[model samples]
Target: MKLIIAVVQDKDSNRLSKHLVKKGYRATKLASTGGFLKEGNTTFLIGVKDDEINDVLDIIQENCRSREQTVSPVSVMGGNVDSYVPYPIEVEVGGATVFVLQVEQFHQL
Candidate 1:
């Protein structure tokens, strides 16, 4: 068995989950936040047989898409407030980070 852990953007979570279900794959979603961008994200926990790993990966790849977004820098409180300026910078987002691990045992109760 294999455990597929996928962290995807919040915007793509619903679509991706729907697609996975349509393909007969079961997934559990957990609400999460990104450390870098401090944005909402969804973590998908999918358990499948070894032979089905590729199918799950393909589905994730097709649903999760990366795109660029412009965001302003966050200013810290009480530091350099007198001469602080916020600038919007373009950064890449909306990509899925996936990890596949071998499961020693899996049982549904």
Candidate 2:
């Protein structure tokens, strides 16, 4: 068995979950917060057979897409504190960070 931990942006969470369910994959979603962007995120816990790892990954890849976003620099993230920059900078966002782990045993009641 394999445990798939996928942390995705909040924007894609709903869509991803729906897609997974439509494909007959069970997933549990948890609300989470991201440290870098200090934004809301969703963590998905998916348990599946070893052979289904690739299928899950493909679904995640197709649903979670990275895109450019403009945001004002914040002082906490090592931005210029002394001066104020009115213009917002472009940064890449909205991607999923996934980890696959081998499960020694899995049982459902």
Candidate 3:
């Protein structure tokens, strides 16, 4: 068995989940946040047999797509001000960070 851990963008979670269900795959979704962008994310846990690993991977590849985005850096309103706000900067965003691991055992009640 294999455990597929996929961290996808929040925007794509719903669609991806639906797609997986339609394809007869079960997945558990959890809300997550990205450390780098501090943005909302969705984590999916899928348990699949060895033979089904490729199918799960194909589904992820089709759903989780990466794109470039522009983002701004944080800036201070005034030099004397203690608080600071981020300014809009261009940066790349979107895409999924995925990890697959071998599972020694899996049981469901």
Best by lDDT: 2
Better of 1 and 3 by lDDT: 1
List of clashing residue pairs for candidate 2: none
Question: What TM-score number comes out for model 2?
Answer: 0.75
Worst 10-residue stretch by lDDT in candidate 2?
A: 73-82
lDDT per residue, candidate 1, 12-51, as tens digits? Answer: 8999999999989999998889763348989999999999
- The C-alpha RMSD of each candidate to the native structure, in angstroms, is 4.8, 4.5, 5.2
Better of 1 and 2 by lDDT: 2
Q: What is the TM-score of each candidate against the true structure?
A: 0.74, 0.75, 0.73
> How many collisions between residues are there in candidate 1?
0
TM-score result, candidate 3: 0.73
The per-model lDDT (C-alpha) reads: 0.85, 0.86, 0.80
Query: lDDT per residue, candidate 3, 1-109, as tens digits?
Result: 9999999888778888998999999999988897632489988999999999888888887876776555444433456555444666444555777888999889998
- Residue 53 lDDT, candidate 1, scale 0-100: 97
On lDDT, the stronger of 2 and 3 is 2
TM-score, model 1 to reference:
0.74
Off by over 4 Å in 3: 36-38, 68-93
Sort by TM-score, best first: what order?
A: 2, 1, 3
